[model samples]
Target: PTMEDFLQPGNKQVAAGYVIYGSSTMLVYTTGRGVYGFTLDPSIGEFCLSHLNIVTPPDGAIYSINEGNYNHFPEGVKKYIEYCKQEDKPTKRPYSARYIGSLVSDFHRNLLKGGIFMYPPTASAPKGKLRLIYECNPIAFLAEQAGGIATDGKNRILDIQPESLHQRVPLYVGSKNMVQKLQEFL
Candidate 1:
């Protein structure tokens, strides 16, 4: 296969999302135009209409990340978290903190509700935990298509070509407004 076989550099990806295996299995994805969701009908063994064209809000009242390992994150991230804590009425500061440690859940919520989810490179693991190909690229595609942004601090997540499989990188993905404001703190 040619370079076309790889979707590492997220720019090549037309769409991406995952199914939530809850009351039903739902598939949500975007094709650079809009995001859609389909529910699996077990009885008919077919995907049925569940969600029509979905769009994320410009901002929200929550931010998601693993704050339990706060000490491991870089100084910039620490500072940003502090900033998020400080109350600012004008800009709607003191946002709620939410972390489920599951990409599908955290990202899906942020995708629909308009928040930010981040995985930053730290003192020990400089590259961060999220894989460039299998995880970040696809998620970034969906985020962008839904009017959001995804980045690895200094670079766009979709712009990075993997040096190898299992390559890890930091990720900041969600509402365009939230991601932009977070970048300022970083």
Candidate 2:
């Protein structure tokens, strides 16, 4: 396909999935229906369905971000980080910080256990950093289908019109309520 053809928006994608290689190989995918996961069984030499109709929780007490960029982040993002560090019992204000530095791994954990993963625009790269097409879009599609949400602070990730094949965008994806709450800070 031509480069232009590859720049289509996320909605144009009929299917999206990722294979995470670790202690166990896993394949997760979606087709606007529901999210499913399969784990490769070495003995069987085949992928078997391990998770079915995956659904993300509406709220979470985990926050994932690279704190090294805290100083370079926008004031809103900084404020949000501070808010996440505060001690509040009823609402779980003091969220556990988890940053694995791998988007797919972090997102996969949150998709199942519930949490928020953030990569907002920084002072050095105000436009943000994650590739919109290959990285953000597919994950965003799965998040939405799995009863979660994905946005670049303001706009929904799936609704964004791709401007370039390598366009980068800020990402805030996770449990529905956590993501919506992050919007207030954005």
Candidate 3:
């Protein structure tokens, strides 16, 4: 039911994969660069990577989060969102919000474009929403490997240890500069 169940280091991975859920069902996976896409191929029973390393834009300007939980967020989180919102006018950056409700999807976007993805502790949930060991740690590893930064608002995610497997902690990952700014706010 959670990301921890999947993406384990020992688990088999298709290098890259994507699912399409409209009209017809399709599961596309790739073992390396040169992304490959595959349709159900009704006649066969297998997933194929037909698309190669599909070019993804590097200047990602979108963000993702559960805005409905905004009311329960800390002052630092609120301030960060406000800053993102102002990135266009006074800030002159022109960034936009794009929440997909899925950490993988959100992170995938960030992987493509150098944007920020935040899952900070809220007023109601003082700790955070994602698990430190399973979720944040692995994701942080991937993000950092892809030239991004992952932190617990103030410190690096990798620098923290999990007291429990399900332990939740604030997560702020993405562009190195953006992550650094978030730390400053914390």
Best model per TM-score: 2
Candidate order, lDDT descending: 2, 1, 3
Q: Which candidate number has the best lDDT?
A: 2
lDDT on C-alpha atoms for all candidate structures: 0.86, 0.93, 0.67
TM-score of each: 0.91, 0.97, 0.68
Total colliding residue pairs, candidate 1:
0
Candidate structures ordered by TM-score, highest first:
2, 1, 3
Please give the lDDT score for candidate 3: 0.67
lDDT (tens digit, per residue) of candidate 3 on 78-176 = 877777777465434656788888887787667666688889888777899898766777667656655677888777787775566677888888877
In candidate 1, what are the lDDT values of residues 1-186, reduced to their tens digit?
Answer: 655476357787866778878778989988888788899999999998787877778887788989988989888788878877889998688988999899888988898788889899877788898899989888888888788899998899999977777889999999998888888888
Q: Give the true-structure RMSD of model 1.
A: 1.9
Better of 2 and 3 by lDDT: 2
lDDT value for model 2: 0.93
* Candidate 1 residue pairs that clash: none
Clash number for every model?
Answer: 0, 0, 12
lDDT for 158 in candidate 1 is 90
